[model samples]
Target: MPWNWTQAEWPNFHYDRAPLERLEQQFLVASGEILGAVRHVSGEDRERLRIDLLSEEAMRTSAIEGEMLDRSSVQSSLRRHFGLGVDIASARPREQGIAEMMVEVYSGFAEPVTDESLCRWHGMLLSHDRGLDMIGAYRRHDEAMQIVSGRIDRQTVHFEAPPSVRVPAEMRAFIDWFNRTTPDGLSPVPALTRAALGHLWFESIHPFEDGNGRIGRALAEKSLAQNIGQPSLIALAYTIERDRRRYYDLLETHQKTLDVTPWILWFGEAVLEAQQVTLARVAFLIAKAKFYDVHRAHLNPRQAKVVERLFRAGPDGFEGGLSAENYIAITGTSRATTTRDLQDLVERGALTRTGERRHTRYRLPI
Candidate 1:
């Protein structure tokens, strides 16, 4: 079967706007709520929030492509980029590269999309690898770019992009369409609609040899940020990573047809879900600040150390809750000392304890 790009209507994508009307309004309302919540955060807490979100995004986006990164390294690289502070002397190339790309996307969202900008992002994303035929540039190899699965003998061709000969022209047109459909352009598409279409169009082109998936996602976030007139704090990549199977299925199905209404709807729902996750993260930060404010005076050195570790786990809380064994490991305290500290924390309302004896666990009050 021929791909959508080979058809007569090729890049002239058509989708019904009637279904997206309600979702667009919901997105705006959610954006306003997040902005309002952010105002109450202290400067220090706000910086922490930014670092956490960016680090999560950098990590998740790479994970979606089967690459796992070091959380500490990514965070440290991001902090250094933002001029917040520096801890480690150097990070692995993969960690440092993705961190640079995420920071660049967040800081330069308002700028128009250009070939140079896209190339720069591509370079940052693949700087660590030394095995690509082309890096920081479009694919020039005279072979078909096909996304495949299964064994080499019985493989399935999910989709095959246009030939290398057509990539330059195809990308030029794609870039023009993206800029022209911006909120302030000649043909202004709605925020979510533009982002969805832009992502699909870029993926269909498959301009680069590698890093297309990551760069395409960054484009979607950039589209959202541009429409909202600020950095969009949505966890788009993290949300997609949670349901990776569905994400790939949707993309594969949409690549076969031009009526992308269903794809747009799915994309909108994902964006909304991502927005909610971000709001919860912001709320968690607020609660964390208040928790520290109330319990700072009562916590001993060992108790304080354990509480800080739990907070690092974010809104999910510590996995399986903090057990007695876990506390001893973290604080290097004796069993008796761990028991006393845990009980003291519970009495002071800093931690909540549950279960009994061997099964006992503790968590933050908030």
Candidate 2:
């Protein structure tokens, strides 16, 4: 559907009042570690959460299904996300951590920030190591790459922008605003509000030729990261990726007037919604962990291997995830046996199907 968009204003966007308050309350409930202070997580505080969730043992063991994440990718993506100049890092670093952090920014409980902070966020997202080398850019710069995602009828764009459309005048001002304004200490407007502003401003400018929407989202996420000082955004993009049609609709609606309120409200609503989803995911994860505790005895060696492989990429996988071929290579098993193992996992509730045939993906169940 040609990357259509829309915008609107709900005045006191039902999101800011109702959804936000509920989200705050729910966050207090989910955090469990700190009820009162969960509303104001700092950078250090955020690292603690990471340490707690992804400790030395946890980092090594944590995986979807029975599969675990490759530490190398994680480290590579982290370095790239931080603008760490790549010396000999792998070509496609693990970006899930950065992606996860971007999702978590949806929660309103973030720290204060400014324009420079925003640009810095963008820099991190489109860092020299991570971003493309575009018009005069050292990183990947060539835009106009068609990275279309979402539904067939209402497909959303992940379009590559033209160099001519690189960061324009007003947009440059906006980035400058973000860099100059956001600071370590400030009367914080809601992070989600700033996220909305950044999203609209970034997209309107169409800064780079490619990855603008994704980068705009990364921009929203960075604003939230600046606000909370925490790097993990729970699931905002997954949410946006899920409801991509409506998101584009709202953008198109708002673009008609160039107003920002409707978009802000929608963005806030998105953050709140992501919180609800992550809360459920956390609960499911804990439940599954408990299941493992009790039923680890019931799982067989191959069954366990199947599960472990799913996280890294089994035969049927997507994104940067592993594939069945990867699984076959890793496990050194025959295709017939591997396919059987994969199908069994899907039936046994160990692996969930993500795609089909050549494009199929499977991972830990939702």
Question: Which candidate comes out best when scored by TM-score?
Answer: 1
Give lDDT per model, in order.
0.92, 0.50
Write candidate 2's Cα lDDT for 227-316 as tens digits. Answer: 555543345665665666788777665544544556666677777676565455444445445556654676667667655554333122
146-176 in candidate 1: lDDT tens per residue?
9999999999999999998999999999989
Clash pairs of candidate 1?
A: none
- Taking all chains together, the TM-score of candidate 2 against the true structure is 0.51
Collision count for each candidate, in order: 0, 59
Cα lDDT, model 2, residue 287: 46
lDDT of 1 at 42: 95
